[model samples]
Target chain A: MNEQEAAALFGALSNDDRLRVIRALVRAGPDGLAAGEIAEAIGASPSRASFHLSTLSEAGFVHAERQARSLRYRVDFDRIGALMRFLLEECCAGHPDLRSCCGS
Target chain B: MNEQEAAALFGALSNDDRLRVIRALVRAGPDGLAAGEIAEAIGASPSRASFHLSTLSEAGFVHAERQARSLRYRVDFDRIGALMRFLLEECCAGHPDLRSCCGS
Candidate 1:
């Protein structure tokens, strides 16, 4: 991904609450989770969860879909992989010798 | 990595200049590049590179080794992996169907 988008993704992750929210989503997995469920999992108020989810959606790290009235949020692996690749490209300064360890 | 360190790493990456600095370092590889060299590569002033490098090292995303007078910077893959994993765990919030795409 381009640097600007990368910055947005990073910015979305930079906050403590948001990171926790994403981690909760990761644990919740392919099923993803509803807004209230995620907030409760991360110990956030409903409003706070909504705010962080908006940030994640804006950054393209997570996608939100409305299931009934509840919003189901899921991780966006494409963007996650893009980030991993961007940071790990030559990764650790070309420890190309160590690339075997990276794919895990 | 724990959430706190993850937050710092994300914060360091949130800026555009720092991301460029890292991309340059990633490109430069295990040889990593000297401070002056990295600055020139990313079109930043030497001092700016120094500040940015300090943030990266502090956040544990990059490492700096002194080669006589100049310090060389390299990506820290372990931390990068940690961040990627932290975000990708059940990843995309549980799309086991998509596991194939993640390890790449």
Candidate 2:
């Protein structure tokens, strides 16, 4: 990704609530979690959770799918992987010290 | 690291100029770069580069060392590795999809 895209992604992740939402969804895995479940997981009010989830969705960090009535949100592993690759390869320039962290 | 610390680090990276500064430093390697050199590399004015550099330094993404008259800045590989580990293990919960990005 380019600098602007990467910065935007990081901007989406710059909030504590969003980071908590991401971790909660990652724990929920591919089956994902409903909004209420995610709210409970993050100890956030439904409205707060929804706001963060929307930001993550907009940033392509989370995917939302309609599950009958409620929308289920899942972490986007491929997008996150792309972000890691950008940091490790593009930002870090594939430096050995940083690469070792990825077990590369 | 916890959510707050991770968020703070991401916040430091949530700007194009800072990201550019980081990539340039990565390219420069451990020898690092002086404020003037970094400003030139990123096409930012000295004052603007200094502002972003200060933010980065405060966030522990980069280290600044006094070298005679100029302060040389370098990316902190260990801290960055810790961040990657946090994302992979804590945030992503060691999920296979995310782990594969790290080649682990």
Of the candidates shown, which would achieve the greatest lDDT relative to the real structure? 2
Question: Residue-wise lDDT of candidate 2 within B8-82, one digit each (tens)?
Answer: 988898899999999999889879999999999999899999999999999998999999999999989888888
Candidate 2 chain A, run of 10 with poorest lDDT: A95-104
Q: Candidate 1: lDDT of B52?
A: 88
The digit string of per-residue lDDT tens for model 2 on A43-90 reads 999999999999999999999999998999999988888888888888
Across residues B19-57, which tens digit of lDDT does each residue of candidate 1 receive?
A: 888777767767988999988987889899889889988
Which residue ranges in model 1 land beyond 4 Å of their true spot? Answer: A90-98, B90-99
- Local distance difference test, per candidate? 0.74, 0.88
Candidate 2 residue runs with Cα over 4 Å from true position = none
State in Å the error of residue A90, model 1.
Answer: 7.6
Q: List chain A TM-scores, every candidate, in order.
A: 0.83, 0.93
Tell me the tens digit of each residue's lDDT in model 1 across A5-41.
7777788788888878877777776889998998898
